[model samples]
Target chain A: MEFYPKLKASIEEIFATMIFLDLTAAEPLAAGTEDLGCHVSAMIGLSGDFNALLGIHCPAKVGLAIGSAMLGMELEEIDDDTKDALGEISNMLAGGIKESFAGENVNLLLALPTTISGKSYKINTPSGSQRVIFPCEIEAGRFYIDFKYSPR
Target chain B: MGKTVLIVDDSNTMRKIVSRALRQAGIDFSEILEASDGQEALDVLAKNKVDIVLSDINMPNMTGLEFLKAKAENAAIKDIPVVMISTETGADIIDQAKALGAKGAVKKPFTPDLINETLGPLL
Candidate 1:
């Protein structure tokens, strides 16, 4: 199934209603350029019908912007609140994706979300895995919603 | 007298957002309590008098479904109303939640009006 549109709609709805931010969807990033200079990332694992990892990657400024907007407080730096905010967003995005799939009769279970942040880091998926990184632009900057899944 | 509501979710960000959304929804509450997981929610319920519960189904320590089952088993808190606010609002899960005593559900990325609509009648 083509998940890009489903994921994109989820992103739009989340930003519109919860974060109170307007965003535009960019073209899906090419495979080789998965890195978007992201300083922070939040990920959650999925199981059941398929095994997958869903993540939201953001640069520092964009992360702060999203976190601040989500919590209705200004976030000066990447802290627990920022991580938690992104993680919850990841969780919500995954849920949206799951709901989309459920419409097609796919079942999925979600794991608790986790965050990764620093000056530098890399995420490597297993060989033969499929992945898509959807870029989204808000006022502060661009962020990516990444979905990697094992071929069913 | 004003009502007290417990917001249960692992994410501090979500708890804050739910609280803010409740205010935006124009729901008045004397105090709002928080818990990161079902166990913590149980602990809070034991210690405080919460009029309602808004919970997330996917969580660590104890999931919302497990929490519902546990809450059903407990005589003291069994009758308190719980409305799920989560992304896990699939028919099977929601049906299970309802069977376990969840009053209703509000999906993630919800608006203030949606929150008010789902939770207003119960209050």
Candidate 2:
């Protein structure tokens, strides 16, 4: 079954209800595309019927905007608060995807979320793994939600 | 006097969001306490009088299910009602929580209205 729609819906629901942000999703990026020039990212691991890594990548300004809206405060810079916010968002998104899979009897367990933020960094997956990167746009800029998983 | 509620989640952002949602739900609570994980929640419960608890399932030190088991054994605080707020609302997990003494569960990405609906009856 296709999981891309589920991922897209999860992003839309989270932004609209909790983050209070407007976003439009673009087509999934081609496999092997470069990182989205994002300064911060949050990821969570999933295991069970299948093993997968789900992540949300955002530029500094975009990350701060999301954090600010979520907390109902203005954030000047990317700090612990911003990282924590994005991490929680990643957890929620993973949960959303997990719930969708559950409907089809594909059970999954979620790990705690972790964050990575710095001037320069890159994420690489093992060869032969499958991935889908969804580019989403908010007023501040663009962000990506990538789901990479091993075939069962 | 208004009720005092405890929110247990590792994410500082989530704790803040839950606090705001409680207010938006129009549930007047005199105080809203917070703890980063279930272990901390136990400490807070030991010191203060919390009317109810909102907890997350996955946490670094002492997950929510483990907290429920510990809370159940402590006669002093066993009776206090707990409602889970997490992305993991699958039936199996929620059933485990309920068996361990959790009163209810609410999924993540929830709204003020949903919070009220789940927590209103218990208050």
lDDT of 1 by residue, A1-152 (tens): 68799989888899999998989999776545344688999999998888899989899999999999999999999999999999989998999989999889888988889998987545544444488877798989988888888855
User: For residues B26-123, what per-residue lDDT tens digits would candidate 1 score against the true structure?
Assistant: 99899999999999999999999999999999888999999999999999999999999998999999999999999999999899999999988998
Q: Report the alpha-carbon TM-score of model 1 versus the true structure.
A: 0.94
Q: Tell me how candidate 2 scores on lDDT.
A: 0.93
Evaluate model 1: give its lDDT: 0.90
Question: Per-residue alpha-carbon lDDT of model 2 for B1-123, expressed as tens digits?
Answer: 899999999999999999999999999999999999999999999999999999999998899999999999999999999999999999999999999999999999999999999999999
lDDT of 2 by residue, A18-59 (tens): 999899999877545375688999999999999999989999
Worst ten in a row by lDDT for model 2 chain A? A120-129
The clash number for model 2 is 0
| Model 2 TM-score on a 0 to 1 scale | 0.96
Query: What TM-score did chain B of candidate 2 earn?
Result: 0.99
DockQ of predictions, in order shown? 0.92, 0.91
